[model samples]
Target: MACQSSLALGLLLLVSCVSWSSATDYTVGDSSGWATSVDYTTWTSGKTFNTGDTLTFNYGSGAHTVDEVSSSDYSSCSASNALSSDSSGTTKTTLKTSGTHYFICGIASHCSNGMKLSVTVAAAASPSTPSSPTTPSTSPGTTTPSTSPPATTTPTATTPSGSMSIGSVRDLAVIGLGGLMGFVLGVF
Candidate 1:
């Protein structure tokens, strides 16, 4: 019975870790919101976009329209061939692929006036996995130590879209604690 419980506990821990991965939601133009006056190019320059991440455009009602367009349409500032359009004052687009995405304001000359955005989406990051330590040779009567360099990760830059949530972190903590408790109980 104890062995069965221990196996179950370990399985739960592995599942919990796998399910903790999440994507981020970014608001375009930051606190300024999405507007013609905002420099879309500069706004997106320093940001890292990835597949599964969402891009939200917020604007005043009837002030602007968000249009997903092809590269040529975006460059030419033409909405005639827009792939999709939204004008409810807010628009959300999920980046589903690894490539370039172009958005423009189709309100008259907004695009020409610089109300355009282009983003290069990278592939979603793979789930992290535990790595084995490196073992070095040691002489007899001496203890050999295993060591490894810490893994380096590139931080993602995020813009505030108001109201932050730590739900994922909280969930992860709860899952981890439950797994630990289960393991302890099974062992003893």
Candidate 2:
């Protein structure tokens, strides 16, 4: 019974750790909300957007329209061929791919008045697997020496988008705890 309980706890921990990686929801225009005269560029500056993240546009109903458009259309402030348009005052768009995404207000003269947003989305970072250490081997009668220097790895920093990041220290700790629990369950 104790073994079963420990196994269950371990499984729960693993599941929770897996669930920690989730998409982020960014509210456009922040406290100012989505409207004209707001510097969308400034709002996007210093913010890191990743694929699977969502952009929520909040505005007064019927006053403005959230229109997703191509780069050319966005440059011209034209929504005649919008990829998607929403006038519900609460537009939610999930970034499905990594690249530049353009948005603008469909209302007349609103986009030209700086009500447009263009954000570059980066691909979501994949969880890195821990690698096993390699052991150097030598022949029984001969010695082999490596000519090249040992390979080194450089770790890149990733900015977390709201939810817990994959492969983060917390994630590693949870994984380690789960593994320990599993080992204890096996022993019992």
Candidate 3:
């Protein structure tokens, strides 16, 4: 147990060393293909985005790639991060700019099947507050991750200058340990 926690702390330090930043991602195959390509594809149309936003593919999805077709195309997908093309079902490229983003499915006949999407994200109001992508669980139309926001009490105004430790782990591990703790304490 000590070894595992040590590993977790080590990993967290490594990642947190660099502030977290990502492009707003859009999943494929949603009913309307929001932030997705044509109906069955990924990349939504005219979905305003800014620098640092990303569009990631889903598990076991297709071999798709996002790229800028030409000079006048997808300024968002250009210059700063002119990624020619990438094939990763788990993660895709980030939209580092705001412009017409033209991406196509580089896989065979995928484009022909209308597996393409273009979106024009407006200039980011502020770089520090980049748009965050919505997850599938909280999918707009899905019943899960529903519209109702969690209830919570407001925090009191306060100031602090010190840092503290936090135990962050995969959800399953957290839940399993939580159950064990509750059972042992006779609170379950």
Candidate 4:
């Protein structure tokens, strides 16, 4: 009975972790939205964008326009030949690929006054590598090395400071819910 309960608890935890690891939605400029007097560069400095995440631009209608432009257009702050433009005061763009996406306001002198945003999206989540194994010793002062090759580890990516990851928050919530369910099932 004890072993079965442990197994069930472990499975529940695994399922919770897997379900929370997914895409997230980010509101640009937070409450300030896409408008003048807001420093978009500083606003997005601490966020880690990933492919499939959504970027939402919120602003007043007719006051500003969101234009998806090329790197050249972004550099020049020119929206005359933008790839796409939206003036609905709210725009949502899903990061379809792992690359840099540039956006700017088509209004006069808006892009020049820090009304542009450049988001760099990373690739989808890859399988995490296990920890490296330590060398074993037979005696306290004497050790024998094995013929096995050294383990290679991939550096884990960390979210930026002052920013919360959507997955991390959801993961915690899922874990708590799993624990509650386990307790109700007498698996605690």
What alpha-carbon RMSD in Å does predicted model 3 have with respect to the real structure? 17.2
TM-score of each: 0.62, 0.77, 0.39, 0.64
lDDT of 4 by residue, 13-110 (tens): 76666666457899999998888878888988967788888999999999999999999999999999998999998999999999899999999999
CA lDDT of each prediction against the hidden true structure: 0.81, 0.85, 0.49, 0.84
Question: What is the per-residue lDDT of model 2 for residues 1-188, given as tens digits with 9 covering 90 to 100?
Answer: 87778777777876676666457799999988899968999999998888889999999999999999999999999999999999998999999999999999999999999999999999766656555557678879987875555565646565556644455757586767867766985786
Cα RMSD (Å) per model?
8.3, 5.4, 17.2, 7.2
- lDDT string, candidate 1, 1-188, tens digits: 87777778777776676666456799999988888789988898868887888999999978999999999999999989999998999899999999999999999988899899999998755555556544566788997555556565545435357633245455667787777777777677
| lDDT tens per residue, model 3, 1-188 | 76556556655654553343433455544433322345632335434455667766553345455444543333222322443665555546577777766665555555555655565655654224334545545556658634554444433322133622122223334565555455545632
For model 4, the superposed segments whose C-alpha errors exceed 4 Å read 1-21, 128-146, 152-154, 159-188
Clashing pairs in 4: none
**What ranges in model 3 sit over 4 Å off?**
1-23, 28-46, 59-67, 71-83, 126-188
Per-residue lDDT value at 19 in model 1: 68
Model 3 vs. true fold: TM: 0.39
Q: Return the TM-score for candidate 4, rounded to 2 decimals.
A: 0.64
Error of 3 at 66 (Å): 4.1
Q: State the displacement of the C-alpha of residue 94, model 3, in Å, after optimal TM-score superposition.
A: 1.3
Q: In model 1, which residue pairs have backbone atoms overlapping below 3 Å?
A: none
